[model samples]
Target: MRRIFLVYALVLVLLSPAFSFAAGWRDGTYEGWSDAGPRSIQYAKVFIQDGEIAGVILREYTDRLVEKDWTCYDYPPFGEAARTLGTKFVEAQLAEIDAYTGATGSSTGWMQAVERALKKAGDAKKEKQYFDGTFLGRSEVADRGYYEVVWVTVENDKITGLQVQRVLADLSVLDPDTYEGFPLEMARQAYAQELIGRDNADVDAISGATGLMNMLNIAVRDALDRASTK
Candidate 1:
């Protein structure tokens, strides 16, 4: 009887990780940097039920508060902003797997830390339901076809991922000089900040990238409409 009990205990111990995450939320922490310069933003995230990421919850530091004049009216949703910032930072760490479109800097920082946390916990998946938007080919330009191509990924009626690239090999269409050092990376970074956490199918077209942005708007609309039917 003692031998059987020991075997059973060993089996459970060996299979611990597989059964550990049945329904409980996973908690994690990481540090993020601000774009405004030398500001250190520390963040934490709790993975709630159904595996949805519960944004970030920022902690306030005495030094930070002391540096600025104490003004309540000017302060926006501080917690919400931290979560937003934290979400981007976590997303940044997963770049090699798939990167966000517009909010690159923040995304990179968050993702870098997230990747470490996830790796340590063995929680990384190739693809997650993070984005829910549909992919609508590329945006059309004049006679040259698509000046810049756009791809949208959405989840929960929100735009979650976006990718922009020159359409195939159609280099003749755009002026090489203007786009040369423009850093095509900004599109991904912008999509991250502006689209995530917002209602899908109604994403505001990005300021520039006219036609490409419009294409993304249409894709988001289509994705939400499809999600509604289901």
Candidate 2:
């Protein structure tokens, strides 16, 4: 009986690491985005359940906020990459994997997005008070029939970076450099200055752009909520 008890204890010790590693993920859906290039932004939505990756949805959108139609003839490689990489990540349970040969760029972006999502889903009790990652959030459509999206970056529990985008009803992104976008540009700059380095969205609204400011506040708060450990 003493020998049998010692053997059982040894087995438990051998399996403990794997058990802890598997329990390091919190079950939830998390969304992340890659840095926006001049032409596009990559997005990943990861679903986790029972501490395992359940599914991944990958998407790329043009600079104008239009989703890329990977099914089109010109984008076959991207379509293939998107279809395969998600399954590969789900199977391997890791984001670092072999990239598709002809679609390396898309594969890299998707991988990065997935990595960020997993970071957000890290076990809260075992990790930092706030996840260090990029989180995306959006505001409900306002009375003007437009909405706002903001990407908030957190590092060391501080809001390190922010990018805001406004989408029109037609799905076109507002060009902040244009004359028509002057007000939005002003509001973006003001709110970014106010919110960066702060953990909360308790900044004051910008005058003359009250509606846009409200949308910005809503979006930022949504993002902070996702980044919170509590």
Candidate 3:
């Protein structure tokens, strides 16, 4: 009777789903908590078997910041959010995912954690694509070129990312000091948000930042032109 019971227990344990996850998780929900400022953010992260970060949604929040001085006060730190929210099963390089506008604090916080996880899983690699960082269109020495900085990234023959650094004539709009810590990072984010999952030449320009859009158009055109030449 004892031998039969032991055999039955072994069979049940071997058949359990948790045991299968010991090999690998097909999908997992990673929970993250952050303390960047006054509020604590809780994250519910979802990922695929390939190690690509599929998606993440904020599961809970405590002390959500209210906007007043152009910045969200008391937001969570990016690293904590990233660590708490990222999964452990990814195996390929990762693309930077979009963060919600106006929630820059939370977005960056979660991104930091996500990036760490991707690195640990060996899914993301560094590459100098068309849009790795900030780029300025230079035609003259006298020009500060702040009005038209374009950010773009390409992968797999597709423009995977974009951003306009400064569109507002008033520098204060992009200034952290004047804007109360919001770094006018919107131009790039706006561009990136629109370009992701899009695979065409005809991209809709941002209305509020038309000047920046014009500059980005020229930059993207240049990148595409270079690709064609190669």
Candidate 4:
């Protein structure tokens, strides 16, 4: 009987990591990352202070669909999760909150991303600034026939400028009207104006051209992620 009890205890010890999590987290900053694809996966960075979550930041999310032989987005019910979801998570801390509006795939994915960040916060708490330099980011539009390229300048750990380069391919003619006006640069140029002096905190979608902004956000995120790697 004693041997059986000992063997059961050993099994629990071996499986502990699956249940291991920070019941009491220290204050600082923690990042939670998710898989690729803005629709399903979300990357989040959270700041904890005085044992309460102080701030939360999210990368742009994409919603894509194939309609009438074109790639388009099916905007989720709640377009922004940082303010709503983040606020709820911070309020609940370790307790689960009602799905931010609903448990649709996007909302569920957002919740999972937040949980991962919180779980990681216990061990690798960090509050590092962006690596200073200029970097390039690129993301393909899947079937949109163009790529969004952004050159971001970082100085003193903050964004100073953004130069956008729209690369149009032969397939760009799929939407013919102007020679290269399909993926307009004007929206990005305006967005560049908005990015000045902002950290990733302010990288929200441009009001009128949010579609382009969503695509650009992925590329911009890639650039920022690369800077972190180096």
Per-candidate TM equals 0.30, 0.68, 0.29, 0.39
For candidate 1, write residues 27-135 as lDDT tens digits.
Answer: 4432221211123222233243233334443333221211222135255444334335655433433313233345344344345434333333344452433333234
Best by TM-score: 2
What is the lDDT for 141 in model 3? Answer: 15
Candidate 2: list runs displaced more than 4 Å.
Answer: 1-55, 61-69, 117-126, 129-136, 175-184, 225-230
Between prediction 2 and prediction 3, the one with superior TM-score is: 2
Error of 1 at 214 (Å): 2.6
Model 2 weakest 10-residue run by lDDT:
16-25
Which order, best to worst by TM-score?
Answer: 2, 4, 1, 3
lDDT of each: 0.42, 0.77, 0.42, 0.57
Q: How close is candidate 2 to the true structure, as a TM-score?
A: 0.68
The ten-residue window of minimal lDDT in model 1 covers 61-70
RMSD of 3: 13.3
Give the better candidate number (3 or 4) by TM-score: 4
Write model 4 residue lDDT over 65-178, tens digit each, in one string: 111111232344444444467777666664255765543554555565566566655555434455455555666665757777666667776778675555566422222235
Clashing residue pairs found in predicted model 2: none
| Winner by lDDT | 2
Residue 182 miss distance in model 4 (angstroms): 25
